[model samples]
Target: LAVEPDIWFLDEPFSALDPLIRREMQDEFLRLQDILKKTIVFITHDFDEAIRLADRIAIMKDGAVIQIGTPEDLIINPATEYVAEFTRDVSRAKVFSARMVMRPLAPDEKGSLGELLKHDVKVQEFADQAVNSEDRIGVTDDAGSIIGVIDRQSVLNVLVGRESAGSY
Candidate 1:
């Protein structure tokens, strides 16, 4: 990182460390990436680590690339059975966003919508709030304009893995 290269290829950079140290290194890595904004190709057999650090992941098997996509994309629509099994244990709410679970706002229900959440905010971030609210929570875009709504059922669906990212 001292030379400021345009890209970095890290293969199990923290694999040798203890659990606590590995987590700290991962945090530090994220902090450095935020400041440097360098493109990174991080290779790891740890799926959880991949989900935490990668914007896009390519799943490979026996030297063949199986699928490539964002964490959300891979979680929601895995390309093959292997991909599905690979991500089956992941928490859906952690990977899905408000935009991915929200329903389109009806014209008559616009005025009744509850608190607004950003489109990219993950379902896990607001699950408790949404579940406790009686009214449907509104989902907003970058401009803060309401584009959709998420009800208690929607939040529950995500928590229970009954909601599909493509359903919204």
Candidate 2:
């Protein structure tokens, strides 16, 4: 019998397996989702796993769902101490995008910079590459057009906690 369901309700389905095998299964499952396009209720105690696999995570504590959000949302704006504690070790630069910290460009600066990056590019991906530059890194939209620029100071403010990513 061919068995296929529209939804996948998985409850620590990989918990019992060896770590290596579990990782493989997680990769395969994510690939399967891309093909089958099914809604998955993936329950995992591993926070990293949840971050990697789930588009939206529902964190439950004491049998109650405490907060539900995208990984970036939960990490940047933790609803409670418990949520913060869980995401405390996560790397903010890896999770936050240029759009999260970029400022709208002034008219005089449009398309002026010789180098540009996408607005949706993750901050860490390009932050280091532009550190030696004298000016802010220009950010572009999908149409290869400048939309905003991420100043070095702004990126530093976010990384050093002088400014909150959620505030932008």
Candidate 3:
């Protein structure tokens, strides 16, 4: 019988597979997630593997979701000491994107610099752009008004952990 369901609740389905095979299955599962758009309830003991797959991870302690969120939410704001320790091994740079660090471009700001840097572009991606540019890029509001400016120096400072980096 052909068995296909809208929602798949897999409980340690790949537990017996070797690490390499398990990784392949995870990739296939993610591909399915992209196409099917179904709710998945995947159970796993490996925290790293869980982080790699689940959209909204629900860390269970005593059969309850201690915390539930995307990987960022779990990393930035861990629920308990265990969760915190679990996320500590993860590299911050790998998890954080450029959009998180990028400031907006402001209007009435006459500069070709800002025009080149797109919103939510990664710091590393923007770093080269910032270096090549001459004028300071103005961070604009939703209404196209100048709110902040991102210059080569500012971008550099933010990337190297010297300055506070975040989204607007």
**Overall lDDT per candidate, in order of appearance:** 0.89, 0.81, 0.66
Ranking by TM-score: 1, 2, 3
Please give each candidate's TM-score.
0.89, 0.77, 0.61
Q: In candidate 3, what are the lDDT values of residues 12-105, reduced to their tens digit? A: 9888999999999999988978888888889888776776787678887877778888766777778899788876766444444444554554
Q: Which ten residues in a row have the lowest lDDT in candidate 1?
A: 159-168
Best by TM-score: 1
Off by over 4 Å in 2: 13-28
Task: Summing lDDT over every window of 10 consecutive residues in candidate 2, give the lowest-scoring window.
Answer: 158-167
lDDT (Cα, tens digit) per residue for candidate 2, span 67-110: 99988889877899999898887777767788788788899987
User: Which residue pairs in candidate 1 collide?
Assistant: none
Sequence-dependent TM-score of model 1? 0.89
Model 3, backbone clash pairs (residues 3+ apart or across chains), number: 10
Pairwise lDDT winner, candidates 1 and 3: 1
